[model samples]
Target: MTEPTRVLIVGGGYVGMYAALRLQRELRRHEARITLVDADSYMTYQPFLPEAAAGNVEPRHVVVSLRRVLDRCRILNGWVVGVDPVARTVDLRPHGGPGRVLEYDILILAPGSVSRTLPIPGLAECGIGFKNLEEAIHLRNHVLGQLDLADSTTDDATRARALTFVFVGAGFAGVEALAELEDMAHDACAYYPTIEPGQMRWILVEATDRILPEVGPEMGRWTLEQLRGRGVDVRIRTRLLSAVGGRVVLDDGTEYDTDTLVWTAGVRPHPLVRATGLPLDAAGRLKATAELTVEGARDVFTAGDCAAVPDLTRPGETCAPNAQNAVRQARTLADNVVATLRGGELRPYRHAYAGSVAGLGLHQGVAQIYGHKLHGMPAWFMHRTYHLSRVPTLNKKVRILIDWTLALLFRREIVSLGQLSDPRKEFERAARADREGRAEEPVLR
Candidate 1:
C-alpha cells in the first residue's frame, strides 16, 4: 500500500489558481493530493481592477473563490511564512490561528509579487494601493466620496483639495486607474450641483517620458496626447518627491495639496519567496529553467512574477511578468508537474510576446497586438473582449456581461459605499453615547 504524493501550492493569484485547477483535472486520485495556501481565499482578476474601481464591473465579479472552483483540492486560507525545501516542509499560519507546519512531497512556489513602493515621505500614511479587490473597492468609494465631500464643503480650499486627484505612476495600473476614475468622476458631476467636471483636477506624474511603454512608444505617445486632450495633467519625466500631509511635491519643483494620492509604481517579488532560502536571480526572482522547475531544486516548481523562467522565444531573456505569460506559465508548469510525477518527459515553457491592451475610460483604449496598433473604440472593444474571455469561469463571465448590459441600459453607478469599510463606526458611537447618557443620569435613593 503506497502513500499518495502530497503537493503544496503557495498562492491564489493567476498562476496559483490556474495551476491548481489544471493539476486537479490531470492528476488521478491515487497519484497526488493537492493543497493550496494563500493570504486570500479568492483570486482577484487584476486586469479588471480599473473597471471595478470605476463601477463598470462589481468588485465581487473580479474575484473567484478558490474553494468553490478548486473543489477537488484542499484550500487553506492563510499566508505561507517560509519554506524548507530540503525538509519538504512549509511554515503556514492559517487565518485566526497560531500556525502550523505542513509537509509535502512537491512544492509549487507561486507566491506572486507585492507592490513596489518607494520610501517617499508620507506615502505609507496617505497613499492608497490598487493591487487587490479591497483596494479597488475602496478606491471607488473614496473617489466618489471625495465628490460628495467636495460638493458639501463651503470652503474653497477644502473643496479644491478634495477634488485634486494625483496618481504617481504612468504604468498600466496607474494609467488605467486614473483614466477610468476621471471618466467616472466626470459622469458623477451631473449629480453634484456645485461640482463641475472642469473644476476637478486629475494629475498623473510619470517618472518616464513615455506612458504604457509595453504597448510601444507611438501608442504611448498617442495615449499621452489623448489624456492631455481630456484635461488630464500628464507630467512626463517627473517623480514624486514627497506627499506629507496631503501635500504632493514633485521632483521638478512643483507642489500641490491633494487628498487623493494613488501609488501604482510597480511590483517586486513576494518577500516569502526570499525566505524560502532558494536560489534567486539578480532581480530577486527565483531562478527556474525552461521546464518551470526551480534551478538546483527539481522538486520545487516556480512561475508567475516570482520565478525568472527562461523565455524560449527570446533565447536569452525571461518571460515578462504579465497576465498573458502568467496564465500560460501556470498551464505549462502544471503539465510538467504531472509529467514528472508519472515519470514522463517534461516539456519546456515557451511564449511569444503578445503586446498589451489598456482601456482609457469608456469607449476609448489603446492596444498593440502582434505588431498591429489599434486605438479608440476598436481598441477599447478588444480590451474588454480579451479580458472578458480570460477572466476565468463561466459564472464570472456571465456576471460581467450582465453588468455591462445593465450599464448600457442605465446610467453607471455613482453612489459611494465608503461606510462599508468602517461599518462598526456608527454602532460604536451609539454604544458610547448610550453609556455616556446613563452616566449622566441621577441615581434614585
Candidate 2:
C-alpha cells in the first residue's frame, strides 16, 4: 500500500479556511493527509468588523471556529516560524511547547498580511490598527470609555480631548469603521444629556487625494461628500506628522490633542514569507502564477493577501488583497491542488472586478456595482445583502440575519461592555492587601 500524501496549510484566514474545507470535501478519504496550523483558532470575517465595533452585530458571530468547520482536517493551534521548501519541512511553535518540525509533500502558504505601519513618533504607543477582532473590540470599548470620561469630567480641556477622535487612513477599513463608530457615538449621546453629538469631533486624514480608491473617483467623491455632510472633518492630501503624548500633528500643520487615534492605513505581507526563501515580488508578496501556485515551486501553492496572483482579466495587474478575491481564489486554488495531486491539468484563476460596496453607517451605504452607483437606504440594504452571502457557513448567516432582524424590531444595542478590556480588574483589586497592612502571617514566626 502507498503512503498518503501529506499537505500542510498555514494561516486560518478566509483563504486558508475555505481551502481546507473544500479540500477535505473534494479529496477522497486517505487520498491526502491534511493539516492546518494557525495562531488563531477561528477565522475572522473582517468585513463585519466595523459593524461588530458599532454593536450592530455581535462580535462573537464574526468569527468561524476552524476546528468546527474543518472537522475532517487535523487542526494545529500554533504559528509557523519558518518554511524550508528545499527540505519540504515547516517549523511551528506551539502555544507553550518548544518548536517542532513537520514534513509535508505539499505546502499551502496563505499566511495573510499584517498592518503596514510607519515610524511616526508615538505611533507605536498610541495608534491602534484595525486588523483583527481584538483590535476591533478594544477600539469599541475605548471609544465608549471616552464617552464615560467626558460625561464624568467638568474640565473643559479633558472633555474636549476625550470627545475628539482621529482616524488616519481613508481606505475601506478606515472609512467604514469611522462612519459606523461615529453613528454609534451619536446614538450613544442620547444616554448622556450633557454630551451633545455636535460637541464630538471626528476627523479623517488621508495622504491620498481621494478616499476608497478601490471604488472609482466618482463614488469616492460621493463618499467624501456624504461623510462631510455628516459633520466629519475629511482632510485629504494630509499626512500624519507625529502623535507624541496624545498630540496629533498633521503635515498640513493642523495640531490637536486627541485621546483616540486609529491607524488603518494599509497592510504588508506577513514577514513569515521572507523567511520561507520563496520568490517574492517587489511588494514582498509571494510571486504566484495565474493558477495560484508559487512560481518555480511545483509542490508549493499560495493565495490571499500574501500572494501576488496575476490578474488574468486585467492582463497587467495582480488581484487586490480583498476578501472577495481571497474567497474566490480559495475555490480555484483548492480545485487546482486536488487536480495537481491527481495528475490532472490546472485551471487559471480569472475573475472580473465586481466593484465595491461600503457601509457609511447603520441604514446608510454606497455601492458602485458594474459602473452603476447607489447610495442611501437602498445601498445599505445591498451592502448587508452582499456580505450576507459571503460570510461563510449557514449558521453564521442565520445568526447575522437574526441580529439584523432584531435591530429593525428593536433599537440597536448601545451598551458598552468596557469591563471586557480589563476583565480581571475587580479580581485584582480584591486580591490586593488591605490599606492598613498585609495580614499577619498565620501563626508563623
Candidate 3:
C-alpha cells in the first residue's frame, strides 16, 4: 500500500459520528484518512429530544458538534447523493459548492432514517414530526403559542381549536413527547389566568393495540393507564384516517378540530441505502452481518437504523431500530472497522434485549429493565440517569444537568419564541415601510 486508505463515511448521526470517533482514536494517522460527509455538522442525541420539547432541558444541549469532538477526522458538511461500490466512488453534493465523485478505498454507509409517512389527506400540510432538534424546538414553541392563542381569543371555536393537541403513534417518541409536553403545558396554565388545565385536550392515536410495545404487553398497559389518569386520551387500536385542515378524523369515527397534529408513526431507512446498489433486506435497509460488515462487500461497513443487522442474540430477528441499539452497534462497528484495517480478528456484535424505560411528564414514568418493573418517580429518575450517561460529550451532559438543577429551583419557562424562526420578518416589513417614506420605526421585537 503506497498510499493511505481513503475511508469515506456518509452521515453525521450515531453510526457515522461514533465510527469516525473510534477509527480516529484507534487507527494510526497515516494508516487511514477519514472523511465524513453529512448535511449537518453536529449529531443530535435523539433520546433527550422529548425533554427538550417539554422545556425540561435546553434544546442546544441535545446536540454534539462533530468538528468539536471528532477533531482527528476531516469533516465535510454535505450530502451523499449516490454511492457505487464497484466504482469505489460516492457522488457528493456539498452544501456550498458543486457536486463531485469522491473515490474511497473503504466505505461506511450510515445515513440513518427518515420519518415513515403514509399517504393521508392533509397530512403533508398539517402534520409535524418529532424527529430532529429543529422540530422539537418548533413543537415546544408551537404548543406554548397555542396556549397563548387560546387565552387571548374571545371566540369559543378558535379557542377550542387552539387548545386541542393530537399525537399519532404511541411508540417511544410519540408517548414520551406527549407526556413531557403535556406536563409542561399543565404547569404553564398557572400563568394564564383565563385558561384551565382541563381546557387543553391531549390525544394519542396508535394503529396498534398497545403503546410502548418494546417493554412488553403488561408494561404497555401500565403506561396506557398512567396516561389516561393524566387526562391524555390514549386511543389504542386506532388509526388516523385524515388530518385535513386540522380536522383530525380517527378510524373509530371520532373527530377533533386540533391545530396541533404530531406525526411520530415510525421511520424508514435513509434513501441513500437504495442508491448504494448494495444488498438490502425486505425492509429496504442495507444487509449487514453479525460483524457489522455489509454482505457481499468486505470493504463496506454499515450499522444504525439504516442497516438491517442480524441480531445474533435472537435468531431470525434483526436488531430493533432504536437509539439504544444504534449506539451499541456503533461501538462494535468501530471496533470491527479497526480490526479490518489492522488485519485482526473481527468480533461479532451481540447483546441480549434489555427492558425499556419511558418518562411520563415530570415526576412520572414507567420502566421494565432486566425483568424488573418500576413506575412513578423512580422510573422517571432511571430515565434521566440512563440518558444522561449516554448523551454524547461531557459538555452536553453537564449543561443538561444544570438545566435540570435550575428547573428544581424555578418554574419551567413557557414563553414562546415563535419569532425566532423568522427574526427578519419584522425587519423586512420596517425596511419596506422606510422605502415607501412612511418614516415609522420598525418593531424589531
Compared with the true structure, all predictions reach lDDT values of 0.92, 0.92, 0.91
Could you tell me the lDDT of residue 83 within candidate 2? 95
Q: What's model 1's overall lDDT? A: 0.92
Q: Write the per-residue lDDT of candidate 1 for residues 1-445, one digit (tens) a residue.
A: 6898999999999999999999999999999999999988899999999999999998899999999999999999888888999999999888886999999999999999989989999999989888998888888899899999899879999899999999988999999999999999999999999988999999999998889998999999999999999999999999999999999999999888998999999899999988988999999999999999999898999999999989998888889999899999999999999998999999999888988999999999999999999999999999999999998899999999999999998999898887788887766766777988854333111
TM-score of each: 0.97, 0.97, 0.96
User: Which model scores highest in TM-score?
Assistant: 1
Cα error, candidate 2, residue 5 (Å): 1.0
Model 3's lDDT to the true fold? 0.91
Candidate 2 stretches with Cα past 4 Å from truth are 435-445
Q: Which residue pairs in candidate 3 have backbone atoms (N, alpha carbon, C) closer than 3 angstroms, thus clashing?
A: none
What lDDT score goes with residue 21 in model 2?
94
Off by over 4 Å in 1: 438-445
Worst 10 residues of 2 by lDDT: 436-445
Quote the positional error of residue 164 for candidate 2 in Å.
0.8
**Residue pairs with backbone overlap in model 1:** none
Candidate 2 C-alpha lDDT tens digits along 173-290: 9999999999999999999878999999999999999999877898899899999999999999999999999999999889989989999999999999999999999999999999
